[model samples]
Target: MDFPKLNLPPVALRTRMGDRGRTMVWDVLRRRYVTLTAEEWVRQHFVHYLLEACGYPAGLLANEMAVEVGGVRRRCDTVLFAREAARPRLIVEYKAPQVPITQEVFNQIQSYNSVLKVDYLIVSNGLQHYCCRMDYAAQQVTFLRGIPRFEELI
Candidate 1:
């Protein structure tokens, strides 16, 4: 299976054919092999971008993180945690390369934010990316010029 070229820096991923001719890729953050869907393809690229280009520590990044929202369990695509406090600092949502990044996409992340209450939010469709810094104190959302480095997040 050929994955679409993402806007993010190219990343090397370990992939293999799984049962029933399914494609699978190794998830370093999860320490397991997961089915390589289109969204997962974008997710893997974004995670590598944060690790290799943005200087985010692998230890602090969690994929498929579960959070309880409105009495239901929802899994966040990726979550960045503070090293010192081990608290969630950022949430990332991924979509297929063909899926347009729209306000509906942002609203999905925002719903997850209501539970995580993270300071940063990111949405990506492999072809395009968006990052926002939420200033709860000021009740404002600032769209960042670009994806921030690990230090900038702190």
Candidate 2:
């Protein structure tokens, strides 16, 4: 796989070539090594950014959490929980750096958020990132300038 360098800040990673002849990166949230594909590369970068730069609480972040949508089971790429396991504070979906973040991507995240009803949503492709703040009362989503700090969320 041609892992392109994205616009996101660089973070040092622990990696190993897997037995299957693929590179793997350590997923701190999931506590395992996953094949370092294009999307996975972006995921690892953004997740690490959330932890090291944004100061997001590690305990609140999870990777590949089970979610039920449209009578089928799906796993969200990453989620930030508030004080409860069922309620997510933020839902994030990642794409490969080459994949453009389009309406379809936004709609996909929205669909996932339908069940989550999270306060915030993020869509990223490593090179670019978008965030929105949800107002259920107003039935509106306000685009944010950037990901809010953990303190700001609290």
Candidate 3:
């Protein structure tokens, strides 16, 4: 299998026998048999990385959740909520590895944030990841080299 260029390490993909005697691999979270799209592939790895490396609680991480903005429905790649508060804290926007990380990606996430009111935003294309903390009060964004660990956020 050809894997996309990612800054993170390769994930362990498992193969299973399909109904038609074809082989299929369980996707991230081992939830379903999905033909791995470039963005899904990156999201799978990143989800595990967040849980293990960053101490983000897997239970608090929501994937492909829908939110409304200006009466328009939009889906977010990933949203991390505070364990105790159950309030959204971080929003992640994922792109296919081949797709460039551009202002449009940020704008899309920002549009979603208008409703979710998350504190931090992350945009990634597997090969590169960008993180920023939103200063809503000041109407500014501060870029960070990486996302803060769960402990730091708490």
Candidate 4:
């Protein structure tokens, strides 16, 4: 598959042929090879950015995390956990490079937040990125100018 160049910094990825010659890319967080779709390509790149560029610990990052919402199980794209508290601090959702980030995407992440209650939420389509800090007490959402470093989140 021909993957488009993303806005994120490029990183080396381990890839291999899977069943029926499908391309599989190694997921560091999941520790397995997952099929490399357009969205997966963006996800892998962003996860690498989070680890190598943003100072987030690998142990504190999770991919395809299960969450319970409205009596249903859903998978969050990426979740960052608090080191000391062991609670979710941030959540990230990814889309294909061609997909535009919209309010529906925000609503989807917000629904997941209902269960995780993370302080930060991020939405990316590889080419564009957005970060929001949720102030539950004030019932306000603050759009961040850029993605914050791991230390800043704490």
| Maximum-lDDT candidate | 4
Q: Report every candidate's CA lDDT.
A: 0.93, 0.90, 0.83, 0.95
Where in model 1 is the C-alpha error above 4 Å?
none
lDDT of 1 by residue, 6-57 (tens): 8988888999999889999999999999999999999999999999999999
Worst 10 residues of 3 by lDDT: 22-31
Candidate number achieving the greatest TM-score relative to the actual structure: 4
Residue 37, model 1: lDDT of 97
* lDDT at residue 43 of model 2 (Cα atoms): 95
| Residue clash pairs of candidate 2 | none
What is the TM-score of each predicted model, taking all chains together? 0.97, 0.95, 0.88, 0.98
Higher-TM-score candidate among 3 and 4?
A: 4
Q: Which residue runs does candidate 4 get wrong by more than 4 Å? A: none
How close is each model in CA RMSD to the real structure?
0.8, 1.3, 2.4, 0.7
The weakest ten consecutive residues by lDDT in model 4 span: 145-154
TM-score for candidate 4? 0.98
Q: How many residue pairs collide in each prediction?
A: 0, 0, 0, 0
- Compute the lDDT for candidate 1: 0.93
Residue 143, model 2: lDDT of 94
Candidate 4 residue-wise lDDT, 1-154, digit = tens: 8999999999899999999899999999999999999999999999999999999999999999999999999999999999988999999999999999999999999999999999999999999999999999999999999999988984
Model 3 stretches with alpha carbons more than 4 Å out: 15-30
* Alpha carbon lDDT at 137, candidate 2: 93
